[model samples]
Target: MKTTKRVIVLAVLLAAVVSGCGEVTVESETTSTGSASEEKSAVAEKSEEASKASDSEVKAEEPTAEESAAEQPAAEEPADTATLGEKNALASAQNYLRFAPFSAQGLREQLEFEGYSSEEVQYAVEHIDADWNEQALKSAQNYLRFAPFSAQGLREQLEFEGYTSEEAQYAIDHCDADWNEQAAKSAQNYLSLMPFSKQELIDQLIFEGYTREQAEYGVSAAGY
Candidate 1:
C-alpha cells in the first residue's frame, strides 16, 4: 500500500508541472501578439502624418499655369497701349509733313509736342521734295504785284519768308522787272504832286532801298 501511494503522488506532481508550463507559454504568446499590434499602430500613425505633411507642402508651393498667365498680362496690357500710342503719334506727324514742307527744326518742335520721335521727324524732313527756288520766285512776284519794292527790300522779304541767300538772289535776277524804269515812274509820279529837289528825290529813293546809280538814272530820266 505504501509503494502504490508514492507512485500516485509522483504522477500528480508531473501533471501539475506540465499544466504550469502550458500556462506560461500561453501568456508569452499573448504578450508577443500585443507588442506586434502596438508596433503596427505606431507605424500606421507615422505613415499618416508623413502623408499629411506632403499634401500641405504641395498646397503651399507654386501657382497654377492659368493663374500665372493671368498675372503677367494684367501687368502688360497698359504698357503695350502706351507704346502703341507713341508709335501712332510719330507716324501721323510723318504723314502730315508730306503735304506741308516745314523747316526741319520747325517741324521737329511741332512734332515733339505731338509726341513724335526725333528720328521720325528727321526722316520726314529728309524725304520732302518741295521746290524752294520756285517758292521763292512766286513769293517775289506776289510782293512786286501787291507792294512795289526795290531789289534790296524784296531780298529782305524773301529772306524773311525762309529763302536762302542764293535762292533770293536767283529770284531777283530772274524776274522780268526793269528797276530803272520802275524807279523813274515812281519818281515822276511823286514829283508831279509834290515838287521835290533832285537831292530830295535821290534821298527818298535811297531810303526806299534803291541803289545810288539806279536813283540818279531814275531822276535824270524823269527830267527832274
Candidate 2:
C-alpha cells in the first residue's frame, strides 16, 4: 500500500510541473508578439512625422505672388508714358517747323537745344510733316528777295542752308528769275556801294559767279 501511494504522488508532481511549463511558454510567446507590434507602430509613426515635416518644408520653400514678382526683372514703364512723351515731342517739332524751314539735322539740333533728349529729338524730326522740296523753294524765294544771285550762286547758297544739291538745283530751275536782269541788278548794287571802272565791274561780276556774257551785259547796262 505504501509503495503504491508514493508512485501516485510522484506522477501527480510530474503532471503539475508539465502544466506550469506550458503556461510559461504561452506567456513568453504573447509578450514577444506584443513587443514586435509596438516596434512596428513606432517605425510607422516616425515615417508619418518625417513625411509631414517634408511637406511643410516644401510649402515654405514656395514663393508668394508678391515675392515672385520682386524676384524677377523689373518691368518697363507703362505704355502710356512712352506714348505721351512721343506726342509732346511731335507737338513741339510742329511748332518749330511752322515758323521756318529746317533740314533734318538742323531740326534735330533745334529740338535738342530746347532740352529734349536725343531720342526724343530724333522721334520728333522724323515724324514732322513737311515737304523738303517745297521748303527749299521757299528758302530760295526769300533769298532772291534779299539779293540777286547767279544760278550757280543761288544753288550754293541753298546747299549751304542745308538743302541737298539736287534740291538746290530743283529750286534754281524752278525759280523764274531772269539771269540777265539779275546780273544787271547785282551790278547796279555793287556800283552803288563803291566806284569802279567798266572793266573792273565786269570782272567783279564774273567773280560773283555770273557768266562772262552776263557780266559784260550787266556792266554796259549799269551805264559804266
Candidate 3:
C-alpha cells in the first residue's frame, strides 16, 4: 500500500509541471503578437503624417492665379492734360501736313486762317515735326511740275510761301533746274497764250527774271 501511494504522488507532480509549461507558452505568444501590432500601427501613423507634410510643401511652392497676374506690367495711359481746342488744332495741323508739306510760318498762317488763336497756332506749329528746308524743296518741285520757273523766280516763290530766306536759297541751290530749258518752256507757254516775235519773247523772258543768254535760247527753242 505505501508503494502504490508513492506512484500516484509522482504522476500528480508530472501533470502539474506540464500544465505550468503550456500556460507559459500561451502567455509569451500573446505578448509577442501584441508588440508586433503596436509597431505596425505607429509606422502607419508616421507614414500618413509625412505624406500630409509633403502635400503641404507642394502647395506652398506654387503661385496662385492672383499673384501671377500681379507680376505683369501695366499698360501706359494717355495724357489727359490737353485742352479740346489744342487737341483739335493739333489734329488739323497734322492732317494738313499729311496731305501737303508746308513751311513753319505757312502752317502757322493756315492754322490762324482756320480761326485758331495765335497761341493755339503757335502750339500747333511748335508741335509739328516739319523740316522747313524739306518743305521748301517740295514746294519748288510742285511749282515746276505745274509750270516752268527760273531759279530766281522759284526762290522768290518759296519766300512768298513763308519760307525763310535761307530755306528759299537752299531750295534754289538744290532745285536742279536748267535755266535755259525753263526759259524755253515759259516762252512756249506764252506763245500758247498769244503770238510774239523773237525779240518780244526774249524781252519778255528777260523781264520775267531770265538772263539775256537764257531768254535768247528760250525764244529759239520756241521756234520763234
Candidate 4:
C-alpha cells in the first residue's frame, strides 16, 4: 500500500510540470504572432505616407516642356532699312563699272555693299552716266601724241578702252589733227637727229608713223 501511494504522487507531479510547459509554449506563440502583425501594420502605414508625399510633390511641380519654351528668348528680326550716303553710293558704282561692264544683278549687289537700299542703288546707277565714248577719244588722243598709229590701230585701241564700234568709228572720222602729215614730220624730226641712208630712213619713217608712200616722200624731202 505505501508503494501505490508513492506512484500516485509522482504521476501528479509529472502532470503538473507538463501543463506548465504547455502554457509557456502557448504564450510564446501568441507573443510572436502579435509582434509580426504590429510590424506589418507599421510597414503598411509608412508605405501609404510615402505614396501621399510623392503625389503632392508631383502635383506641385511646374510643366517642364511649357516652362522651358516660355523661358527661352525670342529670335531677332532683320532690319528693313539700309543707310548710305549718296556720294559714297555713286563712287562705288563707278568703281564697279571700271573693271568691266556689269549686268543689272551684279551692279545691284555692288551697290548693296556700300549700304544703299535696293531702290536707291538702282536709281543712282541709272542716273550716273559713264561716257565710254569720251574715254575712248581721250585714249586715242593720248596714243596719237606719242606716235601716229594707223586708223585700224586707233580703232583697236579705242575698242580696248570700252568704246562701242560706232563710237570708235566716230573718233576716227572726227580726228581734227592730220595724223599722216604729223607722222611724216615726226619721222623727219627723228631722222634729223640721227641721219640714215634713203632706204634706212624710209624704214625708220614708216616705223615712226608715216605710211610707206609718205615715208618715201619724207626721205626724198629730207635730202636723203
TM-score of each: 0.43, 0.59, 0.62, 0.38
Clashing pairs in 4: none
Best by lDDT: 3
Per-model lDDT: 0.74, 0.85, 0.89, 0.71
Ranking by lDDT: 3, 2, 1, 4
> Which residues of candidate 4, in runs, are more than 4 Å off?
1-89, 92-127, 192-195, 204-210, 220-223
Q: Model 1 Cα RMSD, Å?
A: 17.8
lDDT (Cα, 0-100) at 96 in candidate 2: 72
Give the Cα error of residue 205 in candidate 4, in Å: 4.3
Q: Please give the lDDT score at residue 37 for candidate 2.
A: 100
Screening candidate 2 with a backbone cut-off below 3 angstroms (N, C-alpha, C), the clashing residue pairs are none
What's the TM for model 2?
0.59
- lDDT-superior candidate, 1 or 2: 2
Local accuracy of candidate 3 as per-residue lDDT tens digits, 1-224: 99999999988998999999999999999999999999999999999999999999999998899998898788889777766787788899999988987999899899999999888787788777788898898888889999998887888888999999999998888878899999999999999999998899989998888999999999999896
Q: What is the C-alpha RMSD of each candidate to the true structure, in Å?
A: 17.8, 13.6, 9.4, 15.9
| Native-to-model Cα distance after best TM-score fit, residue 39 in candidate 4, in Å | 99
Give the Cα error of residue 80 in candidate 1, in Å: 21
Q: Write the per-residue lDDT of candidate 4 for residues 20-43, one digit (tens) a residue.
A: 999999999999999999999999
Q: Among these predicted structures, which one has the highest TM-score? A: 3
Candidates sorted by TM-score, best first: 3, 2, 1, 4
